[model samples]
Target chain A: MASSISTVPHRAGLGHRLWQSRIDYLFLVPGMVIFGLFILYPLFASQWFSLLNWSGFDANQAFVGFANYAELLQDKYFWDAFARSFIFTLSTVPAQMAVSLVFAIILNNKLLRMSALFRTLIFLPVVTPVAIIGIVMTIMLSPFNGPVNIGLLDAGLINRAIDFLGDPNLVLWTLAGIFVWKWVGVTMVYWLAALQTVPAELYEAAKLDGVKGWQVTFFIVLPMITPFAIVIALISAIGALNVFPLIQSMTQGGPYFASEVMEVYIFRNAFATLNGAVPRLGYASAAGVFFGLAIMVLTILQIFAVRYLRSREKPNGA
Target chain B: MALEAASSAASEYVIRQPLITPRVRRWIVSALLAAVCCIWIYPLVWMVSASFKTNAAIFASEGLIPSQPVFDNYLRAWNEANIGAYFFNTLFVTVGSVLLVTIATAMMGYVLGRRKFLGRGFIFGLLVFTMFVPQGYTIIPVFELLSMLGLGQSLWGVMLATTGGSFVIFVLLFAGYFSQMPDELEEAAKMDGVGFVRTFWYVMLPLSKPIIVTVIVMQTLYAWNDFLLPLVVTLANPAIRTLSVGVYAFKGENFVDWGGMTAASTITIVPVVVLFLFLQRYFIDGLAGAVKG
Candidate 1:
């Protein structure tokens, strides 16, 4: 991709400079080729597709510029799915951060024995495939014979079994809860990494000062890690958009499309034949581009946040 | 010395404390952690145990131990459900993609990290910028492009698409690792009349074992667990479905085959679990390094 840029050196012509550095450029070829083919090209292709009215089934495509985006504005389903994506991010990211933060604190405690065992156990779910998690969670939360419901009933928590994934009202929150459980380990790791940044001398000083443990955590530790929490939250929010497999495996954005987020909505329009809906390739691309832009903005903010955090960490800036 | 003195003094005080003494506190923390662990691992434990249970017994009780264990599910999943094929397919795609990524990123990292080159900053900045762009709906174009090249229905297509990302982090990882190498290493190689490629191949690459292992472990987990691209690429060809896509399809077809589903799920998950157990340190540090990088 950068091959187009012709850099003129003070003592050598562009061609001469290129020949001199041919090996370096040769080394970049394989990766750049793959990147251009799979990533860079498709980005532009998706945008171009968003301008056409083409069913994915055929070659007949009518150029309908921005009509899809206009339609997306009035489309209640599109808006609902878009809103749900944000809702999923909002619902899960904080909960994930909070729970993981507490666990990270517990695991970070020096006095805690067998913390590595506990850490490994908590992290076990992070590596499990999301599709498999969806399948297992479906069974475990099955209303009829699921262990979760059975345990609840056995403990007299409720009069009857609740269809966790079947109820449209309850499904999103249920998926959110499972999402947290599956990914909390990752955020916990991030927190642990961040926690490790705090100098041990600070803790020793706090202990020598007779400060209570909880006070030390709330005062010194929390404030010190606040900057890292921002970056962690951003990463988690970006990850929250990647629930396509989980939703696809467990619910397929069903129970009346209640669990449908933007990704699922785009996927359903682009590929799925469910609900007798035709594959609106162009519109799905438009939705994709739109969501992609939103995520890009979040990502940019995160980059800046990280830069700021780094600057703050190293007072003598690089 | 001061640090040790401070910690030892603190421990002495902790041991003398009343009510919630250090020992009692340790037990309380342990109990709490143990409870959480049981909850966390219950589903995985349940799935593994259920694989051995008969279909009737799976629904009869959600017990961790099967009253009547059976090996039929494994045989059926392996023979009937096509998991055995999908496993190999996943292995092939993962290995191929990892090899591609490792080579490409390592080369890129070495060049950009060790040399001053034209467009280096521009190219590096471009890669970083693209990382933030969510790859929404690009799968359609990728699928179409693969088919256009007449490779869409093949596992090779899946491998290409899987590897066809910015991979900015891995590149940065390699770059950062290589950047920290001593200048003398390169000077020594140059003095011996070794050319750039040979020097990298013989000296630089060998020294980057930790980074390479980190990249391989991370990419293996990604390629093994990746679902969406494999689903799209192999949509027209069930014969080439990877483990993740295959497991989902198998579950869809055999909705009530709980025993078979459990067995297939276990087969899909075991390799990853075992890999993580083995390379747990690399996995954790890799994540931290990526974020830090």
Candidate 2:
């Protein structure tokens, strides 16, 4: 049954339709107000703010049209941080998707005992606050008497203690590894949901056919779940970009700016006055707007991709 | 007779061999998974252990068991670091935001999902459009807005801004759920002469338990763990900091106080962990629902 007033005939004008469902329109007011105030307004205001020379400290502000954006274009540090954000995403998203896909497969096994317990264990970190995880990891990965370093040394895997967060060369990779650990559960949950879409009857048929486990997985299950990978990858890439809290808590983009991602860069420019440099809210806003535009483009691309996939799948009635 | 018996025994041996291999393989997989799970949660376990240790002991040992346990770190984090107050702040903000989002989204989703009225597509399109807009960059304007409204240094501002996220995902979840509800329920409510608001309050809201729980679980984790918003909002007022911001601030101040840091971390983490443990099913369902939406 179509409850929508859209079922009304074309003869019913827009005014009549709206009058028929005035209460429905009223229901939307609160959400719309909040959205306008918080999201829509901020969205435009940020673009406007990017054009000014404001320190975010006082009212002594001046309008500087596109100056911040100009500086951003030439700013080596901004470019490096932007590249580093991509680097973090490139490194972590694949690793997280691959690893979590494996866990999802394992837990999806009916023969596996206590799969719920294992799933819960892997997911515990996801529920735990990232700020807390970063702090705990700092201590847990400390070079001296840290659990991870000690375990590595005892196993003869390393000749000396490794500074996971301190060494500039290793810090970004280290953060990437921790990023995988902290967020793997989320990707795993996605995989688990995708895995559920695979029909049980297909697995049963494979068993009856005497299909080898590996062969069945590669031939049957993989193809069935392949469609979900694109969406899952997109989600993961978005999540990977949001490593601000984790990085902030763990190292604050330290060790001589080796691990500074875009978020850290934006934050430092906007709020932090480090090394006698003044905080530049306008510059940071410009950087943010630039990054936001890039994300918007990516999202548009995603929309097109999703539309293409859906169109392709529709002929197969999938 | 001897030949027949030997042939039967060989068949039985073949059957036993395959069975034994699978059983052993299962044992191996279980053992491996168990080990990995232990290593996965080791940091959390270590955090708890380190919280009980003195700074010297924490530095001297890598063991999961503390060499000498002490309550000083807890006391220090609670009193000196003000984690106790932050705990209350986090609770207040989390509950307020959850309630706000829940009520607002329920109303919006109920209307959008069930009643296709004028401007519905426009509103819905706007919601979906904003979802693509990266939220991290929008903080400056939100901060400015709050400051202009004189909520710059208050927990109330934190609550409002935190609730004011482009929660299109949650709204979609609610919309999807409401759309699936039986039409007869609303039909019956209308027959009883129930008004629009009363129908939602009395029928739709209660019937949408799964969606409500999903929204609450996800929003609680978000509001509880949200660092950036709380950090920026409460930057001017130390007294109103949430656990996340407070813990970060505590870490910054006591860089060398590993013991105290761990204690603060433990304090910040325990409640949510406990909440997850109790509502683990709901959390998984919520996540799955979110992905599906």
Candidate 3:
């Protein structure tokens, strides 16, 4: 895409000097200025604030060399949150990706008559407010009066009613389950879109050889959308790492901090960790920088892997 | 002997099986799919049902339809979530941001789509790159930046900050609703010596309805469903709180208002639900374009 765009010839004339168009610059200025002030400057602030010992307040002024990072290294909660975040990324990304891919495959089968309706129904969760989902999941996962427990108990599936949010062992998985439920549809949508771009002729070619449905799906469909599947997986993984608001609304990183993730920890550290949950700017900033770096490294590695595979396949097929 | 000989001769004929038959297997598959659909739709359906349920029914019944449905909870929820104000704030922001971003992106997309330039490669990359960077990665920076601008907790700040969402613009251009124009129309316009602005105004904009509609629906959804930005930046002020934030607030402040809470949630979901059911063809099409682009 980039190479094609780059090869387009540049015409230099009063009529054709596109850059000279005042409207272009005018359109750009508002977006650029806002992004620079809000997004770019704050990105630099992580480095600046990392150097300062000032708590996350504007009025305070103090300079301490590497103390924030040093303190963070010693923080047990930080490590715990990092571990939990990773665990979530591990569990949720693959489950969500696998489930969504399966769903996409099932829906994308030509034999399915109501593909559009199925696609739309699956995607409804993506459109709804995340907060509302958080609320519903909280109520539904509560041990008492929660339908999950009631149904399980009614069917004699469990000897005991499980407190999903209360048990440290279960809380994270519960959260992961909810996350999958919320996100799998979104992944399916991306996969479905990518699936449509696969030519029908590929399937016809494979079918002519007497290949079964699953074989055709695995060999032909999967490889064609490998780049997209990888991209969506990485995005989901990153989202899991940065998850907070749902944690806050549902578990509040609770059941003895069982469900704590990096983003939730960062929020708690900043706005609610100490002193009636007063803001701890310096500490939170330092943590944010730490987690941000960790996430950036993870995301970049995934991107490179995707790109490598994509290009490797490109010589043969897109 | 004759019958036996005929049966032996016809033994080569095999029983053929259809992919799906109107039988027990079909019944099981449909039943299974129906059960799964119910499970999938359960939470959302429960939210709607619970909103109509009385306090006791909400706490007690897990029925598909409320045992005792009533609208009183919804009425109370309107007051309880402070959601009336939230709706106003959210609507204003969603609409206002869509307007600002769409218009700017359209003009930008139009120019970028139509014009050829050096470093256009870089500009398009820069625009597309924003979509990949999760807003959380930049929230702290964005928050601090908003605070510095003295627009902290202000609606306009939220509107402006999200202006970098060039997605709609990017999609519109790449989809090339503009570029797909019959070159003859543009050639004829050029022959008439119409200025570029006049050409875009009279010709391109009129012809760009499919993409423009697509962008409008998509950006509206983005601006509506976005949670974290408001969660982070709008900490101090309550006036600018959107519907999602308001729902979050209700959950936090009032613990036992399950009926009221889901009621408020129902209100939060109403516009999107209606829009989705009614305007879905375009919404799905637009969303497909976003991912597939």
Interface RMSD of each: 4.4, 8.2, 9.7
In candidate 3, stretches whose alpha carbon ends up further than 4 angstroms from where it belongs are A1-23, A110-113, A205-209, A315-318, B1-30, B110-114, B118-132, B162-192, B199-214
Evaluated on CA atoms against the true complex, candidate 2 attains a DockQ of: 0.37
User: For model 3, what is the alpha-carbon lDDT of residue B273?
Assistant: 70
Question: What DockQ results for candidate 3?
Answer: 0.24
For residue A202, what is the lDDT in candidate 3? 62
Model 3 residue A273 lDDT? 67
lDDT of 3 by residue, A1-318 (tens): 233235545544545555455665665565456455645566667667767766557678588878988999999988898889878889999999898887776665433445556666677777787788889877877787877788888999997889988899988898888888877876886777677777655655665566665566678768888767665765576556646767777887887778878777777766566457656566667777777777666666766887787788777766
How high is the lDDT of residue A218 in model 2?
79
lDDT of 1 at A56: 71
Alpha-carbon RMSD to native, per candidate = 3.7, 5.9, 7.4
- Structure candidate 2, residue pairs in collision: none
- Between candidates 2 and 3, the one scoring higher on DockQ is 2
Candidate 2 backbone overlaps, count: 0
Pick by TM-score: 1 or 3, better one = 1
Indicate the residue-level lDDT of B98 in model 1.
Answer: 93
Model 2's TM-score against the true structure: 0.93
| Best model number under DockQ | 1
Docking model 3 quality class: acceptable
What is the descending lDDT order? 1, 2, 3
Over B217-249, each residue of candidate 2 has an lDDT whose tens digit, in order, gives 888888988888888888778999999889888
